[model samples]
Target: MTVDKESDKGPYICNGTQSSDPEYTQSSDEVTLTVAEKPEPELTSDLKGAALTGNSVTLYCTLKLQSAGWKFYWSKDTQSRETETETNHYFIRSVSVSDEGQYRCRAGRGNPVYYTHYSDALWVTVSGESPPVSLIINPSRSQHFTADSLSLSCEEQRDSTGWTVKRYTL
Candidate 1:
């Protein structure tokens, strides 16, 4: 069985251009670094949609090659080192407006380690404005039988004047 390096890790994305050195060579009297050259680490995020303030955000550092025994480092825009991970990912809990910004990561391996160049930077943003009202559906089921009707409705909280209920046929 192969172990997955990304399992149970938070989601992240690399936003901008990535830089990878073609070859990083380090040799010792008894050992030579013969591992195949690896691509630049990739930064990624789990925000599929809009990210609002006060939510958790997960960031990932991914290597195209095996990431075993690699140490990862992270940095935010215009800042020194933010943090480091022994593994290939990092988590941001309770993200606020301050957390919205560019982030980058890189990896290093072996003693007196040779480091991979930083991955592309990612820009993160959080919205503080109130979210828009959304419609809700009744009879919450994954699959519905044909010819069966479902109830759908939306309500506006302002002055109680924006409540709407409608039905349509599929």
Candidate 2:
């Protein structure tokens, strides 16, 4: 049997002797299969809000891809990235005042990957520490009052003029 090689198609046999078998006379067709690369995961979360100084806050990021399985990574602003290969959730154990900043995440299956970042900065503010100031009231010893009332004001020492005092009667 003589084989014929064609550039457009593939190898074929042009047997010198005509074959009585139909299989030998027929040519086999070839099909090409292609698999697309999966897209990178997307990071989704709300990082902007007011949080207490020592309170724990959770920042979330999600990866949406064509494939079911993937790895997730979390990174603080300008810091080294942390990878969570097994799970989708990223947890911040104790969110501190300094820990407040922009955060991002990346997701991919393997190398040659897709990475989606958070579009806007997750702005977080740490509740201020300065405690509210207390006011002192002193009655004049020289003055004796009968059936009289006194007015005292409680003002914040930081910005005394800016404070609005509210009185509560018990």
Candidate 3:
């Protein structure tokens, strides 16, 4: 019997009776069946934002409760790309603009092949140019007095909304 809903989970018992001169009955131990909804695998990438062209990136597909005998499947832009793959990590040796797309993954295991829901899409963008960032100091000069006031700013060739400034001093 195939169970597909939570409401079907409960305890079950089998009873048997025999008819003769004296009626006899026997009862077996109760057996409980538990059912749970299939979980969706989580998809993640090493690159936090746009990936530079010719750079390598790795995508990982994982489940909360990991088990053995799972085969992973990867898709790009809703198109089936990999099927029945043994590894959970998808490695891209080199990425290009043509590789940019919405990627997703799913896992399947066990006999009769039970499959989990597809993971959330991870959008990958490939940039041809490398991100350029420079630091600008106001009152441009080689020497600065002890109390001299100076302004430090960060400039980027592209968008600087998410850029961070860091400095190391002895």
Candidate 4:
């Protein structure tokens, strides 16, 4: 039997009677049937189109009701990516060629483990080429005095932002 809607849930009891003795009748105990709604997770990407190498991207998985005790799962190319996490969002700090694949996500809750339907696949493509970058140092010189004032900046040919300068000192 199929339950079409939530209103179909209710208590049901069966009654039986003996054909030989029309007056004889028996009633079964009442039983209530419960219907739990299945969750369908929604998957979305922060950036559209193909992502460039060295860029960052984030994927979001969410439910309509937003209940508690939900843990999100992420996968790429049908293979599990990260361990279960409480947060609904998955972040990739620096995208690489290996990161390109069909991504999907799902959510689960409860002890017995009730899982929502996997969200639609989100295709992620990574460009093998990185934007051209040039480093410029003020007072252009190969060597500088310890007390000399110096400045460094990174310039990218593309309009992309979020670049930072890092240095290692001994």
Model 2 lDDT per residue over 36-155, tens place = 333444454444557655555665555444356566677678577565655666665555778777766666555775455533445556674433556544453456488766655665
Over 4 Å off in model 4, which ranges?
1-36, 80-82, 134-170
Error of 2 at 31 (Å): 7.8
lDDT of 1 by residue, 65-145 (tens): 884788998898858855879878788887788888889999988899878888999888877633334466678777888
Model 3, span 51-141: residue lDDT tens: 8987898999998877788999999999855645789999887898988999999999888988899999999899864445666789999
Q: Ranking under lDDT, best-scoring first?
A: 3, 4, 1, 2
Better of 1 and 3 by lDDT: 3
lDDT of 3: 0.84
lDDT of 4 by residue, 37-136 (tens): 7777888998878899998999999899866899999988888554577899999989999989988899988889878888899998997556557677
Candidate 2 residue pairs in backbone clash: none
lDDT of each: 0.73, 0.56, 0.84, 0.84
Cα deviation of 56, candidate 4, in Å: 1.2
lDDT (0-100) at residue 125 of candidate 4? Answer: 92
- For candidate 3, list the clashing residue pairs, or say none: none
Residue 75 lDDT in candidate 1: 92
**Model 4 lDDT, full chain set:** 0.84
TM-score of 1: 0.55
